[model samples]
Target: MSKFKPEPFISCYGGALGAGVDEVGRGPLAGDVVAAAVILDPAAPIAGLADSKKLTERKRELLFVEIQAKALAFCIARASVAEIDRINILQASLLAMTRAVEGLAIQPEHVWVDGNKIPTWRYPAEAVVKGDSRVAAISAASILAKVTRDRELVLLHQQFPDYGFADHKGYPTAVHLAAIEKHGITPHHRQSFGPVKKRLEQLDLF
Candidate 1:
């Protein structure tokens, strides 16, 4: 169990219908940026809520299931590689988070986003420096987004075994960079990213 206890939405925002938003895969070289919005049910308090990065895979998987089952409402959304290339990773991340919050079954009175910036939206929202660790709803949202994106990368690994998506989850690791140098870029790779763009330029030179 984690020693950190996340603050409840009702206590932080003073709202019964508050949603927490978070995004994952922003730094990955491949795959879509995934986001999630979660409205926790105060009646069903989940234990051990913490930042997704702080939790092990097994723990996150367990919490993913629990959050889905217990949350009042939750939505997972994504911004495609094309969208990321068209707009930019940061904008795409915020766009995905916006989609997540908009897709929620129950609209929230206020939204708490996990980062330092909130997307352009109409709902009352505030950005928390480390909401995933400090806010219960944000922790749940982070778990959902992280688990969802990780699972997609695992699936991508099956198709491109040489890239080892399952191992590094598409981040620009040395092995992934080597694979790009050897196998070249895939359709799933974000062409706008620095590493991918440079690799593409190098390939063009050949």
Candidate 2:
């Protein structure tokens, strides 16, 4: 597992204070879409930063705390299921990222966002393809967002054990789809998603 190094990109931007943004839960059928923005302290470097999806849950959980403690600024934000259904997932994701950046304790001079599209915000920003793997700050943001959302799903699981939210984290896996078919949709499920929509239609609730 390769670690992310943001020095190259940071140097390219002339070492300007910058924030890295990333989001999670876009593919999930339930729960909010969560995003995180992190500004790393160059003087205090952290090791083992990598894409959140590539890290184990334990690694992510550990880094999640380290990031908050060492980062110059970090913020986690989310778009509710209702917001996702209203604006569509892509726009909702952008909205969440925007909110995360806006919520940061310290503003950044520039922003590096994971993926090809960025939010329509005032900050000078660049979208990096596979940024979470290439940039340390982006990787930290990814870890924060993923761990935060996964914990929420675990709580949701307690409320609706039949959906198995803890196991799949609201994703439309075989077990999750089967559970939905058996137990019906919950309030947290994203009705706009295909699987959830289909289930809702079958139940004459959509």
- Note the Cα lDDT for every prediction shown: 0.93, 0.92
Q: How far out, in Å, is residue 98 in model 2? A: 0.1
* Candidate 2 local Cα displacement, residue 119, angstroms: 0.6
Please report the candidate that would top TM-score against the real structure: 2
lDDT (Cα, 0-100) at 106 in candidate 2: 96
Return the lDDT, model 2, position 182: 91
**Candidate 2 lDDT tens digits, 60-154:** 99999899999999999999999999999999999999999999999999899999998998998889888998888899999999999999999
Model 1, span 1-206: residue lDDT tens:
87655454334468679999999998999999999999999999999888999999999999999999999999999999999999999999999999999999999999999888989899998888788888889999999999999999999999999999999999999999999989999999999888889988988832
Largest lDDT belongs to which candidate? 1
Q: Model 2 misses residue 129 by how many Å?
A: 0.5
Off by over 4 Å in 1: 1-12
